[model samples]
Each structure stands twice: as C-alpha cells, then as structure tokens.
Target: MKFNFDQRIERRKTKSIKWSSEVLKNMFGEEDLLPLWVADMDFLSPPPVREAMMQEVEHGIFGYSIRSEGYYQSVAKWMEKRFDWKIQKDWIIFMPGVVSAVYYVLQGLLEPGDGVIIQEPVYYPFKSAILDTRCRVINNQLIEHDGRYEMDFEDLEEKAGDPRTKLLVLCSPHNPVGRVWSRDELNKVAQICTKNNVVILSDEIHHDLVYKPHRHHVLANLKEEYRENIITATAPSKTFNLAGMMSAHVICENSEMREKLRKVLDKNHIGMQTPLSMAAVEAAYREGEEWLEELLDYLQGNVHLIRETVKRDLPKAKFSPPQATYLAWIDFRDYGIDGKVLEEKMVKEGKIALDGGTWFGEGGDGFLRVNFACPRETVKEALERIAGVLNKEELK
Candidate 1:
C-alpha cells in the first residue's frame, strides 16, 4: 500500500468526540469502553490535505475568507472526472456542511405544512431537518431482502405524488444499510419526483468512497431533466476525513432554485470558509486521488475481514457486503437479543462501543452499524470483543 493506513495514531486525548469520556458515557451508557461507534475514520487525512492546510496556516492570515476561483474549478473538475458530470460555475453554492445546507433548503423551499419524503433506516438527520423546520415527514421505507436493502419504488411513487409532498431527501449509497443505488433505481426515483412535482436533494456526501465492482450513480447525471430538478450536496469532508473542516458544495442546475438556497444562506449570514479548510478541499480533490484509491482498497480488505470473522466466530450474524462507504450493517437478530440489550452487553461486557441499530429509525433494531475505517488490527479486536461478549465472556 502507498499509505500508512495501519498506523494506530492516538485520538483519545485530542478533544476527540469519539474518545471523550462524557461522550462514551452518554452514547454507550458506559465508561472505559473502546469506541468504534462514530462514523468518522480513525485514519489520518491524505498527505496532500494535511500539507495544504499546513501551508495555509503558515501564511498566518486566519481572518474570514471566501472560496476562490480555483476552489470551484477543483470541484468542477472532480465532478467531471469522477462522475462524468459537467457542472457550471453558477451551479455551485458553498455551505458549511450538508446538514446545514439541508436546513437552509427546507427553510427556503418548503412551507410549514409541506411534506418531505425520506427512506427509512436512513441517516437520522433527514427527519430532524424536516421536523425542525416545521415540515412533515413522509417515510417510504426501503425493502430489506436477503440481507440487503433496496428502495420501494411503489411506496415512494405513492407518497411523493401526494399534493402535500414537496421534497425528497435521498441518502445516496445509503449509510447504515450500504446499498449504492443502481442507475435503474435512480431513474425510477427521478421519474417519480418529476411526476409528483417534488424537488430532489441527493446527498452524495459519500460519493467518492464507493467500493470496486459497483459504481455510484449520480441521480442528476442520469438525465438532463433530472439534473434540472435535483440539488446535489457533495463534499470532500467524508471522502478525505475532513468533516471537522466543514466545507461542502451544493450543486443546483436550476438558477431559481440555486438563488432560493443562496438567499437562505445569505439571511443566516454564513459567508466564511476557513483558509485551511478551503485549501484542504482543493488539495484533496486535486492531489489526493492516489491516497483515496489506496484507502478504498484497505477498506475493502476490512470488509472481507469482518465477513470471515463473523461467519467463523458468530455464525448467526448476517451482513450484506457494502457497495460503498466504510460502515458495516450487521444483523444480530439470530442471536435473539434486543438492540438495546446487545448494545449494553457489547459496551459493558466486551468494552467495545458500536452504533446500535435503533438510532437509524424503525426496522433498525437487531442490527448494528460498525465503522470499519480503521486499522485492520483495530477491526479484528472490535470483532473479537463483540464475539466474546456474545459468548458470555467479560472484558478482562
């Protein structure tokens, strides 16, 4: 490998949320547990990203700054090269993060009583963004079959065609149950949204992290008409472990829709991107390609490790190999343990913290989302901890 992905760098005393004592207590309802719950990777950012940030810091002008021309060009070039999608400079709107952009879009595009549709067992924030903005949530739950997840197009079309439904929040290459939507799935979704007059907000934050043999379909790239109705929220934050920097790009092909979102951002007075973060975005997209490719290869190895370990040690465990993202959704239903009970056992007995299923939403029970973007040894240890807990062995 070209990168040192196995270096076990310490994050515990660095004000890390995943390693904080209070966070451990609050999240796992226990202390002194090894945390693997949070979605962030434990690996260092690509070398180019770190070097760019350091160079920016050396200049010593830490005042508020705006994204420059090269920043947009980098984004454009990335979209073209990675997704084969051409984006105009006017289509790009800068935001602090995808979550923030979601809130702003809801505020600007929908009214109090308008309904927003999202697939169930999705990122929990989609529900919060709607409710917090006084909009209604209409869930079109995905279908889980043979240990995999797929969208329910019939239910989606039924709900989206409703007069009150105005928007759809899509988690591309979805989070917990890692299924990257195929081209056919995306086309169906776009057609449904268009027929129902629903606007589409495709959260492609993890677009760059897809595994081999399966490709990520950019919904807007499927058709010209789809592009006009879709707003794509993408960032290097997820791909390069730069979420702390909090810089994301929202691509809206329609001028009016772009203006509406920009207006909300303007009203909130959010006009600054830290100099280091700005530089990091450019560097990650432009020079971090090789590192990213190597990272994906390492992640694929982690996936195989989990699959083999589960089958050998915990035969009842079932998981669908993820097509994208570093998160693994493992079904522990065959163990006959409730989600909360297993979570407690894992933390208290095994001393390892993992995300319990219920956090994602209904139908998530009996499942656990494991962040596998760590050293191979760490992955092995976490799984061993879980298997030992299942066998009634207490942590030593």
Candidate 2:
C-alpha cells in the first residue's frame, strides 16, 4: 500500500534486453511487440537498493571491490529471518550470477565426460550450462499430473546411481512450472543424490518470491548431511528486479567442495563484484524485505488476473497456480495447437511476446511461460491478447 507498484514506467528507449526494440524484432519478428518473455520485472528496484546504489555513485572512486563482513552478515541475516536457515560467513562465496555459478560448479565438480541430471521442462540455462561444459545432461523428465508437476523419483534415483552422473541441479520453486518443492519432495531428492554420491547444486534464485500460503524449503536446511553435500546459488537480483547488477552468492557448507569450486573461479580469474552491484546486494538483503513483501502481494494479484482472464476468455487454456515466483506456466494443449504455431500466433495475431513452451524441452510442448511481475494492467493486456488469439480460432 505504501509503495506504488501500479505506476507504469516506460522502458522503450532503455537498453533493457526485455524492452529493446531490436531484441523484440529478433525474438518475436515484430518491433512493436509487448515483451513478457523475460523473467525480470518492469518495476523499479526497491528504494533501499536504489538509495544504496546512489550513495555508492556519489563517491567518485569506481574501483574493484571485495565483499566485506557486512555483506556476509546481510545474507546471513536474510537466510535466518526468511528461510530459518542459518548460514555462516565462511559458507558464502560471491559470483556474478546464478547461471555463471552453475557452470563454474559443473566445471569444478564434474569431468568433461561426466553426466549431470536436471528435471525438465525446466530452466533452459540448466541444460545449456551442462552442455557447454562438455558434460552430458541426463534429463529425468518431470511428471505432469493434472496441472501440477512432480519429479519422477525412480528415474532420478536410477540416473543418480549411474557412475557417470556426478551432479544434480535442483531448481527450487522451479521456474516455468512454478511448483515450490516441499520439504518431503526435497528430502527424497537429497536422499537419492546422497545415496549415489551426486552433489546437489540447488538454484534458489526465486526463493524469496514464493506465494504466502506455500513455504519454500531450502534444500540444504533439510539436514546436516544434505547440507554438506549441497551448494546453493541465490541472489537479490531476482528478488529486487536488479538482474543487470550481476551479483550472486554461492552457499557451500562442505569445506572441501567449497575449496574446489573456489579454485575453479581462481583458475578462470573470476571473482570481481562491481561496486554498485555489491552495494545493491547488501542493501537488498538487509533493507529490502518490506519492499519484497509488497511486491509479492502485487504479483499474487497479477497471477489471479491471468488465471481468471484465461478461464473467462479462452475457457480451454489452463494454468497451474504458482506456489513461488511471478512466472506462470500455462498449458495450451486444450486448444490443440502446436507450441511453435501458438507462439507465432501470439506475436503476429496477439502482439504479445511470450516464451514458447517447447523451448523448455519435451513436456513443455503446447505450453507458454508468462511473466506476471508487471503491473495488473500489463498482465491484463497480455492475457487479453492471448485469449483473443485462441478464442478467435475457436469461433471458426
């Protein structure tokens, strides 16, 4: 209520990848497309983050920075207050972003020919990171029941048991699908990985954006043994809509594994955080909690709008209610349209740019991932465009 989340800030001329006209033309084949494909929100960063960065800018000195003790405390306090997971300063290491950290972990932990397991249809970067590192991706495809998604535990266990499989990438509160893994589900995953000697690299980037009724269980918080075997990659970037700041932290409890990962970063010459980024991350974790709560409320409203708009206008399209994150995974199979075809129509006919389901891999076919982190008005407009495209075809 105190913050104005409904204000529409124009990003057209901005260098934002999400709003760039050139990017729009390339991705959607239309220069006038309304973008909802990227995960970043259209809102301004939290006041605390903005103010902190401003203060940092006021100082003329722009120099390389090392993360301070205050930075670690902020993260530690955030983990303790929000997730009830107590993390020590020694357990944290800074990386520019989650995707970068994922690759670094793969390089450090696995051989070039080793296999890594990931659940799909999930974030594409998880697969790309594996492939780029010369590692094999063993997909234990997720099971879609009704509108919800669940892991195929048997397949995961078997894959983990394989000698070549050395790591498991867990997308906590998985993107696209938006199902926040429950404690029991996470326990099952950890147990299987632990039993098979597969280290877990849990990406909790969307951890802070979870819906109120559903809790986010930190994979490492489950048990000491599990914690020792896991590495968590998280940041304030996703939470504060500051992805461009490019700073994230890797939480590792195992000293040996931490040392190995750090060595990889050193060998690659990769441990510098921009002053602005450092200030933003520390301020976000320490003072942006209230802003985040309000943001979640606004996002929940947008989610309802999309779900209701689809039901009333399209009738056939279905969405699984998201438990975490502002991203909505919509199943368009009822329309009997192919993914690529639907994507084309959404842009050409609807003027809306959405992420096609097929881009996420097999089970993603006939689906769409909509980012609902914008204003309620924007979400309504995007959903209306989608509904118009689908409904018009039905009338014929």
Candidate 3:
C-alpha cells in the first residue's frame, strides 16, 4: 500500500466548502450536516506534491513565476505516457481552473444569445458558465436505458444543426451519471458536431480518474480535423486532489481558437499562476502517477461499499456503479419523490448532504450525486444516515 486510504483528516472550520458550516447552511440549509457533495477527495495528496510545496515554502519567497518548458513537458509527457496523446508545448494554456476556463471559452467562442449544447445531468458548472455569459443553454439530455447512460445522438445532431448552436460542452466520463463515453460514442459526437459546424469543447478534467476497462480518449487526438475543431480543458485538480491549488490548462490545436481564448484571458488579465501551484502541478504529473493508481483502487472500494449498502438498506434505490470518477449517480425515483424532496430529506432528516439530481437541470430529478472519495468509514456513515431516512420515508 503506497498510501493509507482510511486516514481521517478533520476539515471542519478550515474554510473547506465541503465541510464549512456557513457553506453547508447555505447549500443544504443545515449548519451541522455531514457534507459528501463536493467533488474533492478527503485524502491527502501525493507525498511528492507535498514535498514540492514544502520545498517552495522553505525558500520563503513567493514571487511571480512564469511556466517553463519543464512544466509544459510534464503535462505533454503525462498525456503521452498515460493517455497516448502526443501534444506539443504550444498547445497548453494555463487557467485558474476548469470552471474559469469554461467562462473564458464561452466569452471567446460565442457572442451573447448564441446557443451551447450540454448533456443534462452533467456537471452543473457547465450550465452555470454558459448562462453567466448570457449564452443560451441547449440541452441534449442523456438517455438512461437499463441503468447505463448513452448519448442522444439524434437530439445532439438536431441541436448541432441549429445555426444558433455554436458550441457543445462535453463531459467525458460524465459526472453524476458516471458513464465513460466509449470511443464509438465520441466518434459520433465528433462527426455530428463537425458536420453541423459546431465547435466542441471537451472537459476532460476527470480524464485520469476513469476506472478499469473504461478508457478515456482525448477527443482532439482522435483526428486531424477533430483537433482543428476542438478545445479541451484538463487538470490534475480532480486527478491529484489539487483543486485548491487553482491550476488548470487548456489544450487547443486550432491556432485561431487558441488566439480567441487568449484574447478573452487577456481581457480579464487572468494569468496569475502561483509558484506553489506550478510546483504542485509539475510534481503531481511527474511523480504522483503511482499514488493515483493506488487512489483509484481505494475509490473503487468506496464505490463498492456504497453500492452494497444502497442495495441492502435503501432497497428501492437504483445505483449504477460509476465507470469513472469518484462520484456515483444514484436514482431514487422508485420512492416516487422529487429530487428536492429527496435532497431535503437527506440533509434535514438524514443529516447528510449530497448534490441534488435536479441541480443538473432537466432529467436529473429523483437522483443524487454522491461523492465517495472519502474514507470507507465516512462513506458508510453517510449511507447509514441516508438509509434510516429513506427506509422510514418508504414506510410512509
């Protein structure tokens, strides 16, 4: 065991959103609720990442720093060695975070009122980012057939064909629903968007966390034409638990698209890359691979624990094991309750906080997204609280 998955760390009152009293009160309306909603892991990052940050702190001078070829090489090599995607140094553009990157992409690619397509029950920020820019959100809701999610290509094609629709924000290894899009599925998306002249923005933030046998193919790397039409946002945040470091980067092969994005970044004056963040990112990709492999093993165990508990305790709930990421998409529609009612019960009655399925927009009702990236005990505790409430509610 390279790392201890059961190690518990106290985060309450640390200004951690997942554990903050004020944030919990605001989000779940309970100051003392146990939060399992945020997408970050409760585990410590890799030792190398910690050592790099410590070394930087020992120097005692946090000054402005510029990214060097080594930083770019770390990213390029990681992508090549891990995902088989050979990208160049020039293709990388550092951003504060993936959510910020989405804001910039919309600002660059679309004018006001232009339509952007996103699959429903996706990561909520995609919709938030689009609307924040005054862009119209066009929904291509995913279809769940027999507990597996598939893209609605017929609907996607129709949406893409609309001239008003200029961008499709794709969540590969999708969130909340957790189905890693297959190669053929991605090919269909590429073809449809290309045929309809819609540019594709693939958020591969969860790219490295895919579970076994479910591979993630960088959409831009699939074809030369696809490369020209795609802009990908990726980070070690989700992969290495570095979200707090505020470091993410975009990969765009199209020179013009890159230029447009750069213009938006420049307009916002957003390039403030910290020295510690740069160190952490490079160390994570260069030295954190082994830790990540072990972390995946731990996450799978957490997934299994939740699945079994749901089956035994909350018998009516439908839990389709996630193919990737630590998030689980659980369907509780059989309880015949709206997502809000289910979410409130989990928060107020169960005393556990989870992301409501309705927050993911249409088709997300009657589901909840559980982040099982914490220790096994935490997963069990949250499920037990949820089980008591759900079981009692079922008897009503």
lDDT of 1 at 340: 86
Q: Lowest summed-lDDT stretch of 10 residues in model 3?
A: 220-229
lDDT of 2 at 338: 78
- Residue 379's C-alpha lDDT in candidate 1? 95
State the TM-score for model 1. 0.97
lDDT of 2 by residue, 253-289 (tens): 9999999999999998998988888899899999999
Give candidate 3's error at residue 292 in angstroms: 0.4
**How high is each candidate's TM-score?**
0.97, 0.98, 0.99
Collision pairs in model 3? none
Q: Candidate 1 at residue 58, lDDT?
A: 88
Q: In angstroms, how far off is 202's CA in candidate 1?
A: 0.4
Q: Report how far off residue 277 is in candidate 1 (Å).
A: 0.3
Clashing pairs in 2: none
What are the Cα lDDT values of the candidates? 0.89, 0.91, 0.91
